[model samples]
Target: MMTDLHVVPARRGRAVRLAKGQAIQIINTHGQQVVDTWCFNADDMSEFMSMEHLHATLQGIFPATGDGLTTNRRRPILILEEDTSPGRHDTVIAACDVHRYAALGCTQYHDNCTDNLRAALGHLDLRTADCPAPLNLWMNIPVSPDGKITWGEPLSKPGDHVTLRAALDCIVVMSTCPQDMIPINGAACTPTEVHYRLIA
Candidate 1:
């Protein structure tokens, strides 16, 4: 049986935290919102997250149940407990920075993903000097047969969400993407919410 969950809407430039063992549900409240996420060991910031290893363990392009999110040292960070919407997430697209903004014709939004990372790091009393690559969740990015990835349409609707349980003491930093130059976070930037609930 699925449990009834509460929903939260996190606007652009906002940050939220999810404790170990608790579940964090990221919802695209306004449809087609891209949430860039970075996970690190709260106790040790040097130990960062690695997406290449994570994808290898999953044995698929996207994450699903029985898949383990591993760290740089190949340690299991989080297990994919549930994926309400699969085949819609992109682990390859790194977080947008100032350079990307300038290249993408949106230099005005120079402080996109970097700012969000700083906010989340500040909340955890961690330093942002070493911002790691992020995991783009709920964003529709498809790789063509020619081995090229192009930004696709929004995969999530107004209420679509993805849930995951923490496998360790992890510090999750997410940015409800405010990218307006592309259609990843919808044509217009919107808010998203992070809901937490402990499993008994």
Candidate 2:
């Protein structure tokens, strides 16, 4: 099978279709950046990958290798094939949006994941609510004993990546999280790269 590669610019997003037995690799080309990611059943846009369902089924808050990320209907969508980061990917936190930035007081045209996903999936009509919160790759959102979640710089270094195998034909969407207001990207955002290919 031929390999497919796509570059996702900083503060932007990209989308791709994956057949079963295929996998998508997300590269954190520049360190300290986060990629907001989610996917859907290629045959049914309404059936989306759900972080909640994954937690309920896996009995864990964050994903682990060998775990299958599931859809809202509890069907497997993708599997966590490999993780080469420091193991700090986040399942908590919603994708960044204008409203979130507005609440943070920088309301003027800030690049965000919500818009990126919508733009990337141009063929589909999606509302913010329609898109669930994503698997935050390279994002460090740690929960303190007090139960407060804090955003910190990623544990991932440059060139680190994670791969997800499609359990079904799927539509994968991702965004280079454009959050400069916080330290999630170490105060700067950068471009990301994605590679896709068949596994066997």
For residues 100-145, could you state the per-residue lDDT of candidate 1 as single tens digits? 8888776464557777788767765677566666778787888889
Question: Candidate 2: global Cα-lDDT?
Answer: 0.81
Candidate No. with top TM-score: 2
TM-score, cand. 1 vs. native: 0.83
Strongest candidate by lDDT: 2
Our model 1 lands, by Cα RMSD against the true structure, at 3.2
- Name the lDDT value of residue 33 in candidate 1: 70
Deviation from native of the Cα of residue 125 in model 2, angstroms: 7.9
**Candidate 2 residue runs with Cα over 4 Å from true position:** 1-4, 123-129, 187-200
lDDT of 2 by residue, 1-200 (tens): 44655677777888878889888887777667788999988888888899888889988777888889999999889999998887788888998888999999984878889888889888455434466889888789889889999878888887787889999998888898888777888755444443333444
**Number of clashes found in candidate 1:** 4
Return the TM-score for each candidate structure: 0.83, 0.90
